[model samples]
Target: KISAIANEYGLSVDLQTKVWQLTVGQQQRVEILKALYREVDILIMDEPTSVLTPQEVDQLFTTLRTLVDDGLTIIFITHKLDEVMQVSDRVTVLRKGKVVATILTTKTDKPSLARLMVGREVIFRLEKSRLERREKILEVNNLQALNDRGIPAIRGVSFDLFGGEILGVAGVSGNGQHELAEALTGLRKSTKGRVFLGKKDVTNSSAREMNDLNVAHIPAERIRIGVVPALSIRENLILKKYRHSPFSYGEFLDNKEIEENACRAISDYHIDAPSCETPVKLLSGGNIQKVVLARELSENPGLIVAVHPTYGLDIGATEQVRQVLLAQRERGAAT
Candidate 1:
């Protein structure tokens, strides 16, 4: 019956696959599958299309329309104005904790909705300065890696990234993007290949070793891999650099210094929280991502490995994130 229902809804995730091994998009499909298995009449989907491919998104819209026609109700929550215009019958715009407007989706356009959500004119286009293409920062030669399921994920990958350059790896979500990022950041070991940091061969180094080498990573799974949710924002900001001077005094953490660092990050990153003492789990997804960025980019890393950095972020926050990366590039950092 489960299989039948999943097929009926066009849910195509592998039942035997481990959740960790699955891509974000596949995991999202599994979540919808879980809901379908329970036979719910109403579904609440938040950022459903964020990780999905264009084709997957279209299929999802078709499925949603079918479900609606068959007397199912869906509460779709997303920051994407176009998705709202496309999928929603009625729209409710929220800013801070208040609802700015709740009207029929057909009655309003994208521009008006954007202004309502942000309380200002929000620019969609971002201008990035030309890449300087300086010295070689990273070299991956014949890199081979396996996924969590012990299946070959990264297959003989090779690339060179230069300082002040942004290299984009384009592929479908399940096609080794995570494995490659892990291999580069030392979270996953490559079976065969030499990874060189400048001239130094640092193949299969530990994650901590990579951190010590000033390698910055913006992981796709924010809550799982990015921040420690139970900890305070202050502690998470100093997660990487806490072992060093000023942040620590022998076995004890320097509370004043930690708080000061947190204050600077909170202010600079524009993180919306009650205070630095607030737990990361309480913050929104965008704020949590800001915390991750603040921690990773603070030391001015030589090489940054970012995977879907601005996924699920609103228009304003997305623009800000891109500008920050461009600024890092301006400092001759490899991205």
Candidate 2:
């Protein structure tokens, strides 16, 4: 029965293959097949395309339409407004545990929906003016790194980033993108070559040293590298600056200064939280991303290293993040 449902949805799976070896898209298919096998009338998917590539998202959408045609009802819960517009027949907007509006997808536009969801006017697009490229501020010379298994991941990669420019690194998963970002941010050691931050050889420097040099990093994994899950938003905001002045005195932290910073960040970044004292883990994914952005970008570093900055964000949040990056670039920060 599972095989039949899989075939009907245009899903291909190997019964002999272990679940751990399956791709993310294949795992999603398996999940759908399990629900179909149980003869459920409705299927609910939460942030289904959060980790998928463009092609994978298209494939998933095709399978969803096929299932819907076969009399299966699907409820896709996602922050991505574009996906909702493309797939949903009717859309429901919720804010702070209350239904704001329920309108037909064909009747509403992205801006209108965003306003309903955020309770304020949202900018859908950003106007980015071109800036004359400045001298190279960061340079990676034949950088190499190893993955967690001590296997070679990055090999002899080199690049130069200039002020007033955004250099985008694109590649398939496991092609050393993560390793490269980590090495550049000093989170991982380079096996060869050197990294120059404006004539300073900072290769294999500690994370603290990189931060002290005014380098900001927005990691791909928010829960793991971005913020502490167990800490409050106020506490997490001061993670990097707690030992410095204003936030600390001698060896003790200044709670009042930390709280003030958190409150200011929350307002400036438009982070939706009950209070600055709220634990970061309890906030939604989009809100957590806002916290990370607020903390990193607020520092106004000389260079910004961002990995998938808008990976799991909604259209509104994605636009905000992009604008922030653009603003940093305009301020002569190499992004």
Candidate whose lDDT is highest: 1
Model 1 over residues 180-225: C-alpha lDDT tens digits?
9999998999989899999999999999999999999999889999
Clashing pairs in 1: none
Q: Indicate which candidate wins on TM-score.
A: 1
Off by over 4 Å in 2: 1-41
Q: Which stretches of candidate 1 lie over 4 Å from their true place?
A: none
How much does each candidate deviate from the true structure in C-alpha RMSD?
1.5, 3.5
lDDT of each: 0.91, 0.85
